[model samples]
Structure formats: C-alpha cells, structure tokens
Target: MTNITFKNNPITLLGEQVTVGSVAPDFSVLANDLSVRTLADYEGKKKLISVVPSIDTGVCDQQTRKFNEEASKIENAVVLTISNDLPFAQSRWCAASGLDNVVTLSDHKDLSFGMNYGVVIEEMRLLARSVFVLNENNEVVYVEYVNEGTDHPNYDKAIEALKSI
Candidate 1:
C-alpha cells in the first residue's frame, strides 16, 4: 500500500503497490458505451494508464489532455485514462473535450482496476493519482503514485520509461 494526500490531508491507499517488472494485473472497467474492457482488449499494444480520482477536476482534465496529445505521436500505443467517475460523466467529459486519442474508462462498477492496481483511496473511494506503463507483454515498465493527489504526475519520466521498455 502507498500513503498519499488529497490537498495536504494524509490518506491510505488500499491493495498492493504495483512494482516494476511484475505483470500488470487485469481489470474490468467500463467504456463510454458501458461495455466492459480489460487488458486483453488491448492485446499486444503498449499502454499508458493514467489513473485519476475523477474526470471533472482540473488536474485530471489536464492530465488526460496531455496524454491524449502524446498518444497521437506514439505508434501502436494505447493511452487509457481510468477514473471512478460514472460512465456517463466520463463520456460527456471526453466528448466535450474532443478527446479521441485516449480512451477514458470507468472503474465505478466494481473498483476492479482501482483495487487491483492498489490505487484505491480508502476513505474517499476514489483513486489516488498514478501513472503506469506496460510493454507489449503486459510487464510493468514504469509506475508512479503521485504523493499528492492534486499534483501533476511525472509525465516526462513515464514517457521516457515507455520508450526504454
């Protein structure tokens, strides 16, 4: 588990911390159409998963947009913006923002991804800010659990790690 903060208030994150070199855990998350999605759905593609508490917040919005822009440049990579926000809200936000490059998924149904990735915020029932990169084999190449939920993740480092893997 990892200790993180929302604003400056400390909170506990549930589940095991994901370490580099481990196989990325598979999880069920919902797409905008309410269809279930998992790692298998992406098959052999490299992945960048951006876990955010909610899509409505400013930081989450910026993070999603930044990744979406980057997704355009990366070949054969899928950028997933995962959140606990409702599917309706996630779809609305993506449509409103014109985000087509990155897929926004909802973990509200079961918190499957949140729990499996050990990013669940115990008190808030939301996800702590985190970024993960998985190579084609689904091995974790990079993992970043932002100590502060409201702060931005190390985007450059994550991308560099992705390139290396």
Candidate 2:
C-alpha cells in the first residue's frame, strides 16, 4: 500500500509492497509476441524492471525509451518495461518507436505482475510508475514506488543500483 498519486489526486494501490533485500516475487506477463514470461525467464541476470501505467502515454514513452537506451550499456542485465497495455498495443508501440533494447511486457490479461509487485492502481486498473532492480540471485536490491504516478522514476539511482549488482 505505497502512497502515490495520479495528476495530484491520491489513489489506492492493491497488493503487498515489496522491499529491498526481499526475494523478488515472480509474475506472469505477456511479451510482445503474446508469449507468457515470468521472472524465471531472466534467471541468473541482474534485472531492471521498469513499470509504467501505459505505454501510449507521454511519460511512459520517455520512461521506456530511457531504459531502452540504457540497456545496452548495462552488462549482464536486462531491461524490462512492464505495463498494463495489451500485447498488441505494446508490440505496436515498440515497433513504432524502434526500441530494441527493453523488453515490453503486458499485464492486461490478469494483472499478475501488477498485483504481485504491488504497483496495481486500484482505481484505474493500471500499474503505477515504479522501478525495481534485482540481483542475479533474484533478491531485490532496489525498489522505487514513485510517489507520483505520472512522473519519471529516479533513473540515475536505479541505474546505479543495477550497476552495483
């Protein structure tokens, strides 16, 4: 139940909030190809999971693109951008934006990633803007549930954490 807001209006989020040093939770989300992907899919690699409300929005676009650009510089890691958008829409957006680094995943089918990661916005059925970095052992090294849903995440901090892992 992290406190956050959308456009300055307070909103409720569902599910248990994760914390640093905890075992990272596993979730099922749809890849751009409509295939199911889970945390295990990226085992043995440091991961930076970037959660956004929707991929079509302006801030979301910037967030995803930022991580996508940083992905190549990150060694032994993967950049994942999770959103509530449909797989079709996610694919479309990725293709249109020509983004190849970050892997876009969708939680629209069952909100698996949204609820498991505690980023689900109860009022809007969309994920709040958040960033998580996990070590190779799947332990959370950094977690940021952005205080404001529409704002950019602390990219420098997240990247630093990822690099430290």
Candidate 3:
C-alpha cells in the first residue's frame, strides 16, 4: 500500500510496490496500434518505464516530452510512457507533440501495468506519476513513486540509473 496524494488528498494504491533490486513485474499493455505489448517486447534492452495517470495533463505532457527528448540520444534502450489513456488518444498526443522517440503505451484495457507497479489510484482509477528503470535482465535498477501525483519525477536520477546499467 504505497500512500500518495492527488491535490493534497491521500490516495490509496493497489498491488505491491516494487523496490530497487527487485525483479521487475511483467505486464501487458496496448500500443498505439492496439497491439498487445509486454515486458518481453523489449527483452535484453534497458527500459525506462514512465507511468502517468493521463497523458493529456500538463505534468504528463512535460514528462513524456522530456523522456522523448532523452530517449533519442540513448542507445539500446526504450523509453515507454504508460498511461490509462486510450490508444487513439495516446497516438494523437504523440503525433501532435511530434515526439517519436518515446513509445506511448495504454494500460486502460487491463490495468496490468498500473496494478503491477502499484501506482493505481484506487479513488480516481488513475495511475500515479512514477518512473521505473529496468536492466536487461528485467531487474529494477531504480524506482520513483512520486509523492505528489502532479509533481515531476527525478528525471536526472532515472536517466542516470538507465545509463549506469
């Protein structure tokens, strides 16, 4: 039960919270094409999993854009922006932003990623703002469950963790 907040109101989260050194949980999500994507999709590559409640929000927009910019310069790595938004909306947002580097995934259908990562906001049915870095072996190298749902994650630390792997 990871305790977080949205607009100063305490929010409950579902599932077990992952920690550094733990094996990253496998989950299924939908890509922009509506195809199922899972952890195996990026096997043997570093994964930067950026979780957000919704992509259309101001903080989410910035987080995705920032990760997109960073993803382009990274090699053998995949930056994924996961949200509960529909695949259509995720595709549209990526296109409108011209952010082609980061992959936008939708977990609205099953909430697999949300529940596995323990970022699901029980009250609002949204994922809390969080970031996770996984090594090639699917081991979590870094995890940040933002205390405030609207605050920005420690971008530098997450990127450094990915680079360190």
Candidate 4:
C-alpha cells in the first residue's frame, strides 16, 4: 500500500505498489465506448499510464492534456489517461479537448485498475495521481505515485523511462 494526500489531508491507498521490473498487473478499465479494455490490449507496445483522481479538476485536465500532446511525439508507445470518472464524462472530456493521441479509460465500473495498481484512494473512491511506464513485454519500467492527489506526477521522468524501452 501507498500513502497520499488530498488538499493536505492524508489518505490511505489500497493495493500493491508497482515496482519497476515486475510484471504489470492486468485489470479492466472502461474505454470511451463502454467496452472493457485491459493491459493485454496494448501488448507488444510500450504503455504510459497517467492515473488521475478526477478529469473534472484543473490539475487532472492539464496532466491529461500534456500527455495527449506528448503522445504524438512518442513512437511505438501509447499514453493512457485513467480515472474513476464515468465513461460518459471521460468521453465528453476527450471529445471536447480533442485529445485523440492519448486514450482515456475509466475505472468507475469496478475500480479494477485502481485496486490492481495501488492508486485507489479508499475514502474518496478515486484514483490517486500517478504515472506508470511499461515495456513492450508488460514489465513495469517506471512508476511515480505522486505524493499529493492534486499535484502532477513527474512527467519528464516518466517520459524518460519510456525512452529507455
């Protein structure tokens, strides 16, 4: 488990921390079309996952937008922006923002992605801010569990880790 804070109040996170070199956990998240999407869908390509508490917030918006922009420059890699927000909201946000390069997935269905990745905030029922980089083989290459829910993860560091893959 990992610890995090929301507006400075400490909160407990549920699930195991994803360590680099370990096999990435497989979990289901809802795609914009309400289809179940899993880690296996991105097999054979590097994955950069951006976990956010809520897409409606300012910080989360910026984080997702940044990754969407960066996704175009990254070859053979996909950027996934995940949240506990409903699939409807996620779709609306992505359509409004024109974030085609990055994919937005929702864990609202069962919190599978959150529970499996150790980013779920038990009290808030939202995913904590974090970033994970996985290699083509589905091995975790980098992980940054942001200390604060409202704060952004180390984007540069996560991107740099992707370069090594």
Candidate 5:
C-alpha cells in the first residue's frame, strides 16, 4: 500500500509500485481507437508516461498539453498521457486542444494500469499525478510523483532525464 494525501487528508492505495530503476509493468490500456495497447506497442522507442487523476481537471489538462508540446521536439520518444477517463473523452480533449503528438491512453476498464503503476487513488477512484520515463527496454529511468494533488510536475527535469537516457 502507498500513502498519499488529498486536500490535507491522508489516503491509502493498494498496489505494488513501479519505481525508478524498476522494470515497468506491462499493461493493456485502451487507446483512442478503443483497441488494447500494451507496453510492447511502444517497443524500440523512448516512452514518457504521464499519469494524471483525470483529463477533465485543469492540472491534468495542463500536464497533457505540456507533454504534447514537448513530445514534438523529442526524437524517437512517445509521450503517453494516461488517465481513467474514457477513450472518447480523451479523443475529444486531444482534438479540442490540438494535442496531436501525445498518445492518450485510457485505463477505465480494469484499472490495472493505475494499480500496477501505484498511482491509483483508492478513495477517490482516480490516479495520482505522476510521470515515468522509460527506455526502449521498458526500464524506468526517471520517475516523479507529484506530492501535491493539484500541482504540475517538473517537466524540464523530466525532459532532461529522458535526454540523458
């Protein structure tokens, strides 16, 4: 179990976590097309997993847009914005925001992505705001779990870490 606080109240989650230097857990997430996409789908490419509570919130939307913008300049890297939102909602948000570079994956079906990644907010039925960067082998090289639920992550550091890989 992992402990996180929301609105100054402690919350507990149930799951083993993916940490820095840990091999990323493979997950079957729903894609914009409603097709199942596993970690292997991004094989041979650098990956950035942007985990957010929900895409409907301001912070989550900002994180997704920031990553989408940065993704265009990173060669051989795929930025995946992950959340519990439905694929249709993800598609709409991406289209509305002109976020073409980032791939938004939905974890609404089984919630295994959140559970395995250790970002699920058990009490709220949401994901914790976090980011994980992985190499082609799916080994996590960088990780950031934003302590504050409403805060954005340090994108510059995350990008630099990815560049170092």
Candidate 6:
C-alpha cells in the first residue's frame, strides 16, 4: 500500500502504485455513453490519465480544462480525466465547460481504476490527485503523485514528458 496525505493528513492507499517503466494496469471505466472502456480501447495512442478527486472541485475542474486545451496541440494522444464521479455528471461538466478534447471517465461502478492505480482515498470516496503518462505500447513513461491534495499539479512538466514520447 502507498502512504499519501489528503490536505496534509495521512491516508493509506489500497494497492501498489504504478511506476514508470511498469505496464499500466488494465481498467474498465465508464465512458460518457455509459459504455465500458478498457486500456485496449486507446491502443496506438499516447495516454494521459489525469486522475483527480472530482470535477466538482475548482482545482479538478481547472485541471480538466487545461488538459483539454493542451490535448488539441498534442498529436496522437488521448487525455482521460478520471474521477469517482458518475458518467452523467462527468458528461455534463465537460459539455458545460466546453471540454471537447479530453475524455472524462468514471470509476463509480467497480472502483478498480483507483485501486489499480493506487490513488483511491481510503476513507473518502474519492481519488488522490495523480497523473500517469503512458506510451503507445501501454508502458508507463511518467508519473506524478501530488503531495498536497489541494494544490494544482505541475502541468508544464507533464506536458514536457508527453511531448517527449
């Protein structure tokens, strides 16, 4: 288990964290259409998993929008904004915010995405703020586990890493 803190308070995650150079765990997340989507669905594309606590929060919403804007400039890449929110809510937020480039995925059903990625908050029904960049071959190339739960992530670094792949 990985030890992380929420708002400076310590919390324990449920599973082993995915590391750079390791193969990302496969997950069946709920798409906006309520259809199940797996890792294979993004084959041959660089994947950016922007795992956040929820889009309802200000920081999370900003991150999704920022990534959505960056997604258009990044060629052959899929930016997935993942959270524990329901598919309907995710879709609504995206549509309202005009977030067309990024895909918001939900892990409300099985909760395997958070467990497998080691970002699930133990007590709360939310995910830790994290980012994982994967190559077209499905190998993890970059990872960031935000130490402070409330702060925004370093998008510049993540974008730099994605551009390298």
| Per-model C-alpha RMSD | 1.1, 1.0, 1.1, 1.2, 1.5, 1.4
Tens digit of lDDT per residue, candidate 2, span 54-158? Answer: 999999999989877876688899989999999899999988998765699999999998888888899999999999999999999999999998889999999
TM-score of 4: 0.96
Lowest-lDDT window of 10 residues in candidate 1?
Answer: 67-76
Q: List TM-scores for all candidates, in order.
A: 0.96, 0.97, 0.96, 0.96, 0.94, 0.95
Candidate 5, residues 1-165: lDDT per residue as tens digits?
335677767766546677788999999899999999999999999999999888989989998888878866888898999999999999998889875666999988988888888888888888888899999899999988787778889999898877777
Find the number of clashing residue pairs for candidate 4: 0
Model 1: per-residue Cα lDDT over 1-165, one tens digit each? 456899999988988778999999999999999999999999899899999999999999999998778766778888899999999999899889976656999999898999899999999999999999999999999999999999999989987777776
Candidate 2 C-alpha error for residue 109, in Å:
0.8
Candidate 5's C-alpha lDDT? 0.86
- Candidate 3 residue runs with Cα over 4 Å from true position: none
User: Candidate 2 vs candidate 4: which has greater lDDT?
Assistant: 2
Quantify all predictions' global Cα lDDT against the true fold.
0.90, 0.91, 0.90, 0.88, 0.86, 0.87
* TM-score between model 5 and native: 0.94
Residues 6-117, model 3: lDDT tens digits: 9889999987789999999999999999999999999999999999889999999999888767766778888999989999999999889976666999999999999998
Error of 4 at 78 (Å): 0.2
Residue 160 CA error for candidate 1 (Å)? 1.1
| Cα shift from native, residue 87, model 3 (Å) | 0.4
Model 5 Cα shift for residue 20 (angstroms): 1.5
Q: What lDDT does candidate 5 reach at residue 85?
A: 94
Q: By TM-score, is 3 or 5 better?
A: 3
Better of 2 and 5 by TM-score: 2
Better of 2 and 5 by lDDT: 2
Q: How does candidate 2 fare on TM-score?
A: 0.97
Tens digits of per-residue lDDT, candidate 4, 19-113, equal 88899999999998999999999989988999999898999999988876776577899988999999999988988887665699999989999
